[model samples]
Target: MESFSLLLRGFSVALLPWNLLWAFVGVVLGTVVGILPGIGPALTVALLLPVTYDLEPVSAFIMFAGIYSGAMYGGSTTSILMNTPGESGSMITALEGHEMARAGRASAALATAAIGSFVAGTIGTVGLTLAAPLLARVALTFGPAEYFALMVLGFSTISAVLGETPIRGLVSLFFGLALGLVGIDLQTGEARFTLGLPQLLDGIDVVVVVVGLFAVGETLHVVSRPHHASFITKVRGWTWMTRADWSRSWKPWLRGTVLGFPVGALPTGGVVIPTFLSYWLERRLSKNPEEFGRGAIEGVAGPEAANNAAAAGVLVPLLTLGLPTSATAAILLAAFQQYNLQPGPLLFVTNPSLVWGLIASLYIGNLALLLLNLPLAPLWARLLEIPQPLLYGGILVFATVGTYSLNSSVFDVGLMSVIGVVGYFMRRFDVPVAPAIIGMILGPLAEQQFRRALAISQGEMSVFLTRPLSATVLALAVLVLVIPSLLRLLRARAAHQGRP
Candidate 1:
C-alpha cells in the first residue's frame, strides 16, 4: 500500500507536461538511434549524457527511461528487416524475424515484436516496482564487510560471465581497476597515478571512457573491417496480427517475462542470456517446432519479449544495489553520479520521489514506444540504408563534442582519443568492454568499503572472513571464478582418458 501511494505520487511528477515532452523526445531519439546498426542503447545514452547535464535530474532520468525502452523496441526493426542486430539481445530476433521478412510477413513480425515488447516491458516494470524496495530494505542490513564482499562477487561474476573467456574479461576488469586508481587516494589524500597532470586529480570521467569504447572504438573497428551490404525489407503497410499469431505469441510473452526478470536482476545475468534461453525454450515448447527455423512468429515474439523484460529487470540491481549488470546499466549508473545522486538503499530513502517518478515514467515510456514504433517502423527501416562511413563519422564527431563538453578542456578530448584507440584494440582482440566499465565504476567503492571494514576491525585482516554474511558472499565469489575452470579441467581429463 505504501509503495502504491508512492507510485501514485510518482505519476504526478511523470505526467507533468514538460516531463512528458521529454519522455516523448527520448523515445523518438532512442528509436532513431536504435535502428541504426552498431549503435545500441548504451552508446546512445553515453552520447546524450553531456547534453543532459543542465537538465533537472528527474527529467533527465525520465528521458533515459524512455530511451531505454524505446531502444529495446526499435532494435528489433533492423533485426527483422535487415537481419542486422543492433545489439546482442536482438540476435535471436533476427534468426526468425528476418526469415519472416523474407516470407513477406514482415509486418506481422514487427507487430508481434512490438506488442510482445509492450506486454513484457510493462510486466517487468511491475516486477521492478515491487522488488526494488524490498531489496533495498534487505541491503540496509549490509555492513561494510558485507558490502565489500558483494562487490567482489559482482567483479567475479561479471568477469566470468561477460566475455568469451574469463581470462580476457579479468584482464579488462583489471585495466579498469588500474584506471580507477589514477585519481587522488581517498584515504591518504595523495596523488597516486596522475603523473603531475592536474586534470587527473578528479579522475577520468566515465563518459569519456564509455564514449571512447562504445562510439569511437566501435567506429574505428567498423572502418577497419570489411564492409558488408545490408538488405532492408519494406513494410507494405501498417499490419495487424492474426488470431493465430496472438494465440502463439501471448504465452511466450508471459513466459519470457517470467524467465527474464529474475535473471536480469542478477549481478551477471545480462540481457543476452535470457533472450537466448527464451528462444530455445520457445522452440522446444512450440507446437510447430519445424516453423522455428522458418518464419515462426513465436521466435520473434518470445525473444523480443525477453529482451525488453531483461532490460527492465536490469534496473533492479542498479537502483537497489548500485550494481550495474549490463553496459547500459553501467552508463545509467554514471548518469546517477552526474546528478550527485548515489544509487542503493539510501537512494530510496533520500529520493523517493525521484525513484518512484522514474518508475512511473517507465510505464509511460512503454506506451509512448508502442505508439511510436508501430507507425514509424517503416521509416526507421529506412535508417538501415544509411551509409556506414557517414554514420560512423557522425558518431566520432558527436563523441568528440560530448567529451569536450564534459570539462570544456581540450585535454579531455585528447584523453578520449587515446582511450578510443585503446578501446579499438580491445575490440580487435575480442576483449569484452562491459566488465571494464563495471570494474571502473565499482572498483573505487569496493576499495572504500574494504578500508572501512579494516578500520572497524582495527586493522584485523580476518574481518572479511569472520563475518558470516561477508564470508558467504566471498565464498560465492570464489566459486563463481573457480567452477568454470574446474569443469573445463574435468572435461579435458575425461577426453584424454577416452583417447587412451
Candidate 2:
C-alpha cells in the first residue's frame, strides 16, 4: 500500500503538462532513431546529454525513460520489414519476422511485435515499481562464479538455434568466438588479434557485424541471384492479427515477460540472453517447431516481448543499486552524475519525486508507444512495395552509412563488406548465423567472469562447484546439453528394435 501511494505521487509529477510534452517528444525521437539502423538508445541518450544541461532533472529523466522504452518498440519495425535490426536486442526478431514479411504476413508480425512489446513493457514497469528493491538485492548476490555459470547456461541454448545439423552450428559458433577474441586482453594489456591495426585494438563492433550479416550480405546474395524471384511479397490487405494469431501470441508474450524480467534485473544480465532464451523456449514449447525459421508468430512475439521486458529489467539495478548492467543504463548513470545526483537507496528517499516520476513515465511512455506504433504497423510493412532493385540499393547505402557512423572509420566499412561476403557463404552453406552471433557476444563475457572467479578464489576451480547457486546453474546447463541427445538416442534405439 505504501508503494501504491508513492506511485500515485509519482503520477502527479509525471502528468504535468510540460513533463508530458517532453515525454512525447522523447518517444517520437526515439522511435525515429530506432527505425534507422545502427543508432540505439545508448547513443541517442548520450547525444542528448549535452543538450539537456539546463533542463530540470525530473523532466530530463522522464524524457530519457520515454526514449528508452520507445526505442525498444521502434526497433522491431525495421527487423520485421527490412531484415535489419535497429538495435542488437531486435536481432532475433529479424530472423522470423522478415520471413513473415516474405510470406505476406508482415502486418501480423508487426501487430504481435507491437502488442507484445506493450504487454511486456507495462508488466515489466510494474515489476520495476513494486519489486525493484527486492530484485536489486537478489542481483547483488551474483558473484563471478555464479555469473560464469549463468553464461554456461546461456551457451547451452545454442542447440535450439543451430539449424539443420549440429556440425554446421558448431562451425558458425566457433567463428563467432574467434571474432570475439580479436581485441586486446583486458588484464594483461596484450594485443591478441589486432594484426598490427590500431583500429582493431578496440574490437569489432556488434553493430557492424549485425548490419553486415543481415543487410549487406542479404543485398549481395539477392543481387547475385537476379534470376530468382523477388524476396518481397505483396500485402493482400492491412489485416491485423486473426483469432488464431491472438491465441498463439498471447501465451508467448506472457512467458517471455516471465523469462525477461528476472534475468534483466541481474547485474550481469542484458537484453541478449533473455531474448535468445525466450526464442528457444518458444521453439521448444511450440506445437509446430519446424515453422520457427519460416516465420512463426510465436518466434516474433516471444523474443520481442523479452527484448522490451529486458529493457525495463535493466532499470531495476540502475535505480536501486546504482549498477549499470547494459550500455544504455551506463549512459543513464552518466546522466545522473551530470546532474550532481547519485542513484542508490538514498536517492529514493532524498529524491523520491525524480525516482518515482521516472518510473511513472515508463508506464506513460509504454502506452504512448503502443498508440503511436500500432496504427503505423501496416504503413511500415508497405516498405516492401518498392521495386526490388531500388529497395536493395537503398539497403546497401543505409548499411554502409550506419556501419561508418559507429567510429567514422572507412576501415570499418571495408571490414563490414568482408564480413558480408562471409555471411553470404554461410547462407550458401545453410549454416545457422544465430549461433555465431550468440558465441561472439557470450564467449568474451564468459571468459571474463571465469577469470574473475578464479582470481578471487586463488585459481581454485572448485569455487564453481562449491557455491550452491553456481553448481545448480552448471547442472542445468549440463542437462540442457545432454537431455536432447539422450532423447534422440532412445528414439533411435526404439525404432531400430521395432524394425528388426
Candidate 3:
C-alpha cells in the first residue's frame, strides 16, 4: 500500500499538463524517426540528450520515457507497411504483419498490433512497479565479479545468438570493440590506438558512432540500391478490430506478456529476443501453423505484445542495477549520466521523484500512444509513397546535421564517412549491427568492472568462479558461445549419415 501510494503520487507529478505535453511531443518525434529506416529510439535519444541538459528534470524524463515507449510502437508501422523492419524487435512482426498487408488485411493487423502493444506495455509497467525493489535487492548483493560475469554473459548472448550467423556477428562485435578501444586508456590515460591524432584522444562520441553506423550507413546502403516498387499501397476496409480479431489476439497477448518479462529482465539484447520467442511460441501453438507465414493474426499480436512488454521489462533492470540490456537502454544510461544521475541499487533512495515519476509516465505514455496511433495509421503509411532516393537522401543530411551539431567537429563528420562505409560492408555480408552497437557500448564498461574485480581480489582470477552468481553468469556465457558450434557439428553429422 505504501508503494502504491507513492506510485499514485508519482502519477500526480507525471500528469501535470506540461509533462503530458512533453510526452505527446516525444511520441510524435519517436514515431517519425521510427517510421524512417535506420534512425531509431537510440539515435534519436542520443541526439536529444544534450538538448535535455537545460530542461526540467521531470519533463526531460517524461520525454525520454515517451521516446522509449513510442519507438516500440513506431517500429511496427514500418514493419507492416514497408516490409523493412524499423528495428530488430519488429522483425517477427514483419513476418506476419507484412503478410497480412499482402492479404489486404492491413487494418486488422495494425489494429491488433496497437491494442496488444498497449496491453503489454500497461501490464509490463505494472510488473515493474511491483517487482523492482526486490530485483534491486538481488542486484545489490552482486559484487564486482558478479557484475563482470553478468556483462560477459550479456555480450556473449547478444552477439552470438541473435544474428544471421554467429561468425559474422562476432566479427561485427570485434569491429565495435575495436572502435571502443580507440579512445585513451581509462586507467593510465595512455593512447593505445590513436595513431598520434589529437581527435582520437577524446574517444569517439556515442552520437557519432551511432549516427555513422546506423544513419549514414543505412542511407548509403539504400542509395546504393534502386528500388522500383509502386508509390502507393491499396489500403482498404474497416480500421477497427472485429470481435473475432479480438478473440484470436487476446490470448497471445497474455501469453506474450508472461513470456516476455523474464527475458527482458535478463541482460541480453532488449526486446528482440522476447519478440522472436513469442512469435515462435505462437506459431507452435497456433491452430494453423500454415497460417503463420500467410497473415496469421496471432503472429502480429504475440510479437507486438512481447515487444512492448519486453521494452517495459527492460526498464526494471536498467533502473535497478544500471545494467542496460539493449543498445537503446545503454543510450538511456548515458542520459542518466548526462543528468548527473546514476541508476543502480541506490537510485530509488537517491532520486525517488525521477524514478517513480518516470515509471508513472509510462502508464500515461502507453495510453497516449494507443490514441495517437489508432486513427493515424494511414498518415504513417503514406511514407511508402515518398521516393526512396529523397527519403534516404534526407536521412543522410539529417544524420550529418545531428552529428555536426553535437560537437561541430568536421573531423567527426569525416570519421562518420569512414564508419559508414565499414557498416555498409557489414550489412552486405549479413553481419548484424545491433551486436556491434552493444559491444561498443559495453566494452569499456566491462573492462573497467573487470579491472575493479581483479583489484578487489588481489588479481585473483578465481574470484569470478568463487562467487555463485558470477559462476552462473560466466557459465551461461560459455554455454551461449559453445552451443552454436555443437549444433553445427550435430547437423553435419546427421547430414553425413543421411539421418533425418
TM-score versus the correct structure, for each prediction: 0.97, 0.64, 0.94
TM-score, cand. 2 vs. native: 0.64
Q: In model 3, what is the error at residue 327, expressed in angstroms?
A: 1.9
Against the true structure, what is every candidate's RMSD? Answer: 1.4, 7.2, 2.1
Give the least accurate 10-residue stretch of model 2, judged by summed lDDT: 228-237
lDDT of 1 by residue, 295-372 (tens): 999999999999999998999989998888788888899899989999999999999989999999999999988988
* lDDT for 221 (candidate 1): 86
- Per-residue lDDT tens digits for candidate 3, residues 407-454, read 778998999888888888877777877777777767787888899999
- Candidate 1 residue pairs in backbone clash: none
- Candidate order by decreasing TM-score: 1, 3, 2
Cα deviation of 446, candidate 1, in Å:
1.2
Model 2 residue 88 CA deviation (Å) reads 12
Model 1 clash number? 0
Clashing pairs in 2: none
Q: Per lDDT, what order, best first?
A: 1, 3, 2
